[model samples]
Target: MQVDPGDPVEVNIWEAYIRTAVTHAEQDVSLVELERAAFYERCRNAYAVVATGESALYANLIIRKGVVAAG
Candidate 1:
């Protein structure tokens, strides 16, 4: 798919949101904790799963972070 170069900033914003969601879901940790590859993998996995059920032409994802109770 061809993306307009003018939309890069918006793309990066979405990328950040996906990465943050992945970091939280996969590791239950902060985004700062994961290395780039691990973080990207998590986001990739999430996108793969979510995209299967996504019906919209424009990308619209909503990810919720699960709460971890303190022991």
Candidate 2:
């Protein structure tokens, strides 16, 4: 599936958050060989990855309040 880049990329940020719990509160994933759409969907469904990188494989968890507008 071709990720239209319109749906929003999500990610699993628990690990990142764990690492940055007191340091930052965000995580990162290195996806350089995965499909664009697949990466996006994975991130979107992830209850963690709060933020997404320019590509799709890279992502971070956002802390704050509301949902990250994928912007």
* TM-score of each model, in listed order: 0.25, 0.25
**Whole-model lDDT values for every prediction:** 0.48, 0.46
Error of 1 at 7 (Å): 7.4
Q: Which stretches of candidate 2 lie over 4 Å from their true place?
A: 1-32, 52-71
lDDT per residue (tens digit) for residues 1-71 in model 2 = 23345667555444454566556434443224345665566667656653345443434233334445676
Q: Which regions in candidate 1 have their CA more than 4 angstroms from the true location?
A: 1-10, 26-61, 64-71
lDDT of 1 at 40: 52
| Position 45, candidate 1: lDDT | 61
Tens-digit per-residue lDDT, 1-71, candidate 1: 12333555333444555576766565654333344455456666663544466443324443435777899
Cα shift from native, residue 7, model 2 (Å): 21
